[model samples]
Target: MPRPLRSENLQGTLDLLVLKTLAARGALHGYAISTHIQQVSDDFLRVEEGSLYPALHRIEGLGWISSEWSTSSTNRRVKLYSLTAAGRRQLEIEQKRWDELTLAVKKVLECYG
Candidate 1:
């Protein structure tokens, strides 16, 4: 059996992922954010706690996202993260960057291979 490619180096795209996820799914807790990314990517993208929480905090610090304390289904206090207007704008920027990056990679692949 072949091994699945490890996407651990996806740190560069973490901000875009979080922003897009919150934009699409509305507000979600930290763990929910992690799981959502993994599930959406068919388990190919795994956001570890060591990586995710920091990104969440950094994004909140940038004022791209707002956090609120909310009770979860399990009756535990959780911080819900939601996208802000700035985040939406950032999402657009990130999307553009991603598109350009993919296009560039495709060109390199076509030229070299």
Candidate 2:
């Protein structure tokens, strides 16, 4: 079974996950993105809609993402989000940073362990 996520750990990783999801899936609405993350994590991570919306808006503002109103699978109107070309570039950069940070953290833990 998957362990529960630590919010502090998740905080640093959320953006990468979002960007990766958008890259892989093309476009997804906010709720779908949240559900995808949760499912992918095997329900170990829980994302609040409030936090998700603000993050989406922030990414959109950063020009890393874009959104448009569209009908969901349920035929309900929703704002669909997709990664921009800039976002794809940003994801590569961010992913590199994440890998470096995780390696550093792992090294530190190894030293102490």
Candidate 3:
């Protein structure tokens, strides 16, 4: 059986995942973002609420994302997050960095094996 993923490793990739999620969906509330990540990962990834809010706030402060209190489709009030123009640009840069990191790690693992 495969070992479960650690939160420490997930922490390093949370921002990228969040950016991808917002980019793909356009806009999403905090709860939806967490739920989507968990669902899409088939429950392999567990996004803790504690870590998620801080990351959201950090990205918003960086101007990579914007948020507003809006009503969801179910009519409940929530802070819906969306990527700004700057955010999209940043996402492109980050995605490239992530791809590079992934490739480098893969190469290292291949060499070790």
Of the candidates shown, which would achieve the greatest TM-score relative to the real structure?
1
lDDT score of residue 46 within candidate 2: 72
Model 1 residue 63 lDDT score: 94
- Estimate, for each residue in 1-113, the C-alpha lDDT of model 2 and write its tens digit: 86777434578677888899999888999888888888898888877787788889999999999999988778989999999999999999999999999899999999988
Give Cα-based local distance difference scores for all models.
0.90, 0.87, 0.87
Candidate 3 — which residues are off by over 4 angstroms? 1-8
Candidate 3: 10-residue stretch with minimal lDDT: 1-10
lDDT of 3 by residue, 1-113 (tens): 45545445586688888899999998999888988888898777778778889999999999999999998778989999999999899889889999999999999999989
- Cα deviation of 88, candidate 1, in Å: 0.3
Error of 3 at 112 (Å): 2.4
TM-score of 3: 0.89
TM-scores of all models?
Answer: 0.93, 0.90, 0.89
Better of 2 and 3 by TM-score: 2
Report the Cα lDDT for residue 21, model 1. 96
What lDDT does model 2 reach? 0.87
